[model samples]
Target chain A: MDVLLTSTAEAFRLLFSGNPEIWEIVGISFRVSSMAILAAVPPALVIAFTLAYGSFPGRRFLISLFNTFLSVPAVVIGLTLFIILSRQGPMGDFKLLFTQTAMGLGQFFLCLPILVCMAHVSLQAADRAAWETARTLGANRLRAFFTVLYEIRFGLTAALLAGYGRIISEVGASMMLGGNIAHYTRNIPTAIALETSKGAFAEGIALGIVLLFLAFVLNSLLQYVQGKGSINP
Target chain B: MIENFRIGFREISKSFGSNQVLEQTAISIASHDCIVITGNNGAGKTTLLRIIAGLEKPGHCEISLDDASPEPWRRLRKRLLKSVMYLHQQPYMFAGSLLRNIEYAARLNPALADRESSVQKAVSWAGLEGLESQSAASLSGGQKQRVALTRARLCHPQVLLLDEPTANLDSESRERTLQMLREFRDSGTAIVIVTHDPGVFSDLATSKLHLQDHRIQADDIGAADVVELDSVRQSKKR
Candidate 1:
């Protein structure tokens, strides 16, 4: 406990001093997660709308398949991508292993199911009248689709927040696929893991503090977008 | 009857699982005419209107305009969407102001010139002058109806399918709605209004249809009759 107390104080000092290592890690974390979400959102929305409103063969089967995938463990996803990116695996020709892109690819898959599941629920709960009304108002399929999407914009925003939250703090895929290389792919969560294993609790504590702050900032932004947070600041 | 357009529906049917609604039904609507559809609750009146509006596809059905008959439903799909507009019992508002809802339809129509003026005219025509900037969700029932009417008017569809438009309105609102329908009819828009209130539609209906037992029966209400048949039926208690 005494060690923990001193280490926490040192962590605060490192954080307040604008440590370069901490900043680099935080920046990498943000870049990878943001890119992954950007890649995931469009496809997630398309899949979700198709599942919710479309009438086609195997729709029920596809929905059930996605629902089953919703519970897939993150470590399982990391392992699956690890093999796929490895030299002996099917996708090894690209040699994307141990790169930021590989980690991002894993994170993209992780975020997609969350987005599709939540957005599908949101679209299902939406008023059917909106779609029919848009159609009858002389909107073709494309125009009516956009109108329905607008009606559910708030829910879409929430889906994005949830997806971002899921990927930003994830450590498993980043460590495995990114190799946690310092100055290249080391993110906050990976740095915290490395520091804690090495008994450098100050760096670990410092990275943990930054990660917590990141979570706070993300949640604050989300609440503000949802019209639930303080506007004073 | 107008030669250029006539809405034809043939042998349309629909069901939800084991429960059937419309079963092998047909109807034809001409331009500048008003048809009142009447039935008891769950008698498929709304379903028929939905099929006519092309919002719901019939189980075994075909529809067309003019004399394009026998499997012309495929051809009807394209024209059905352009020439028909449906008004729900409780109309839905797009996510913005009243003006946006009207202009949304106007934007899609390539022929609507002076979009802003067209929206303004629709608003004023519906007697909704000052509520332009308000969110459509905040409007009263009658105001919502008028907004929906304004949307339909801006689209300028040749056929309008209304499902229980006056079901929830007050007497004054109902009268205002009927008056608007009269005006639209005068401007040569074919209207198929579904209502249980016979008094509201008596004067405007060129014909009356009653759906019962999954079949459409043309009622004996004469074109000149103005009696409230629904009210009289209600007093007799079935």
Candidate 2:
């Protein structure tokens, strides 16, 4: 308990001191995760809307496929992406292995199923009248789609936050794909792992605190949005 | 001013699973026409209106416009949607302010020379001026209906399909809604209303139809006949 308390106190000191190295890792984590989620949202929303509103053969099969992927192990994702991005693989010609782009790609795939599943649930729960009203009001199909999307903006925002949370803190995919290089590919989770393994408890605890702080902020934002969405006044 | 418009749908049928809601339904609508359709619950009155609005796809359907060749409903659905506005039984108010909902429709209408002025005019026309800044979804059912009418006014659709536009409204609100529908009809908009209480719309309906057993039966009553019937019903109530 004493050691833990001391480490936590030292962690705060390091955070407040604005240590360059620790902040760099934080920046990299945010940059990569933000890019990944940004790249994933549009396609995820389209797929989710399709699954919710579209009538087509194999729709149930596709939904089930995505639901199944929700529980896939992050390490497995890393391994599969690793194999595909390695030399002699089909995509290996891109020379993307051990790069931030590769890490972002892994994170994109990691969060896509979550985004799709959550957004699908939201779209299903939304009133179909929104789409019909927009169309009947002279909106084209694309405009109607966006109008419905705006109607369910709260749900889409929550899905995005959840996806961002999942990818930002995930260790296996980031560790494997990024190679955890200092200054370039190092991120919070990878830095924490390396620091703790090297007995640098203060650094690890500091980064852990950052992650916890982020989780708290994100969860608070989610709750606020949900509350706003549910209450009419 | 609205131009001459005619829409006719024939052989329209819709089924969910094994239950058929509408079968071989045919209806014709023309500019300045007010058609009040009455029916029992589950009688497919709403389905017929939705098919006319192009919001629902009938299993088999054909459509004809004014002086144009008859075409399959699927081919002309986009055009049908452009000219038709369908209001739900409980009108859905979008998530923003009432003015925003009106502005949304006004923005889509290219004929509205100035969107802001048009929205303002619609707000005043609907008596929704004081409520423009209020959240649409927070309004009462009657207020939401008014907001929907305001939007429809901005869009200026040639055909207005209403599903129970006065289902849950106070008498005063119902009268206001009828007044608005009267204005739309006077402007040559084809108004199709599905209602259980057709008496409330007697003054506005040019013709009455009944939906029974998955088919529409046209009644020969003219507007004057409906108005007389409504007075009789009112006198009986007194």
Candidate 3:
């Protein structure tokens, strides 16, 4: 307990002391995760909307498939991409192995199912009247779609926050794909792993503190958004 | 102002799996006409209204406009959408101020050359002048109905389809809705109301129809008739 307390205190000092190395890792984590999420949102929303509102064959199958993907282990995703991006594999021609792009690619696939399933739930919970109302008021199909999106904005925001929280803290995919290359692809989770393995618990604890803070912030935001949308809140 | 029009929605067939709601239903609507449709629960009165408003797709549908050639319902969806508006039994308000809700319809109408002034006029027309800044969700059922009417006023649809506009309102709200609807009829817009209480609209309804056995029956607005609508030959003799 004494060692743990000392390490936590030292971690805070390192975090607040303008440590270039730690913040660089933080920056890389945010940049890669932000890009991954930004690329995933639009397609996820479309798929989610289709799954919720569209009537066609295989819709239930797709919904089940995405829900299944939500439980996939992060390290499994890392290993699959590692094999695919290896020189002996098909996509090796791109030479994307051990690069930030590879790490981003891994994170992208990781968060896409999360965004789809959650956004699908959000769309399903929304009233069908908003769409009909907009269309009957002379809005084209596209405009009506936007109107419905606005109506469910709170739920969508919560989905986004949940998705961002998932991708930003995952260490397995970043470790295998990025190889923890310092100052290039090394992110918070990867750096924390390396630091702890090397017995540098202070830095590791500092990064852990950041993750905890982020989780708290995200959960708080999610609570507020859900509260605003609830009828009894 | 909306141009006068006569629309015939012919051969509408809708079913939910094994349960058929409407089969070979037909109805004709013309400008300045107030049509009140009554039927038992589950008789598909709302379904027929939605079909006329182009909000639902019937199994096989055709339409004739102003005595023109009959066209496939799918082909004239945009035209129907432009000229028809359907108000729900309980008005669904968007998440915004009342002004925003009114402005939403105003924006969709490209004919409103000056959107701001048109919205202001509509707000005042609905007697919602002092409540423009209030949240739409907080309004009573009557105010919501007025807001829906305001939205219809801005759109100026030739056909306004209302589903139980007075079902959940108090007496005052019901009277106010009727007054507004009377004004809508006087402005040359065709009003089609689906209600359980046909007697409520007797003073203003130009015609009344009954939906039974998956069909809308009767011929004239001023006549008291309820016959099966096997194949309504809704030919406009104009």
Docking class for candidate 3: high
Tens-place lDDT per residue, model 2, B3-79, is 98777777889998899998887877877878889999998988888888888988999988876877999999998
DockQ for candidate 2: 0.77
- Residue-level lDDT tens digits of model 3 in B1-238: 4577788888889998999999987787888778889889999999988888888988888899987998989999888888899999988999989999999999998988999998998888888999999989999989999999999999999999999998988898888889999999888898999998887887778767888999887735433323222222132211
The stretch of ten residues in a row with the least summed lDDT in candidate 1 chain A is: A224-233
lDDT of 3 at B230: 20
Q: Give every candidate's TM-score on chain A.
A: 0.92, 0.98, 0.96
Cα displacement (angstroms), candidate 3, residue B24, comes to 1.4
lDDT of 2 by residue, A16-134 (tens): 99999999999999999999999999999899999999999999999999999999988899999999999977899999988999999999999999999999999999999999899
Tens digit per residue, CA lDDT, model 1, A96-201: 9889999899899999998998889989988999999988877888878778888888778888888888888889888999999998889888899999999999
Q: TM-score for model 2? A: 0.94
- CA lDDT scores, all candidates in order: 0.83, 0.89, 0.89
Can you give the lDDT of residue A85 in candidate 2?
Answer: 97
* Alpha-carbon runs more than 4 Å astray in model 3: A230-233, B219-238
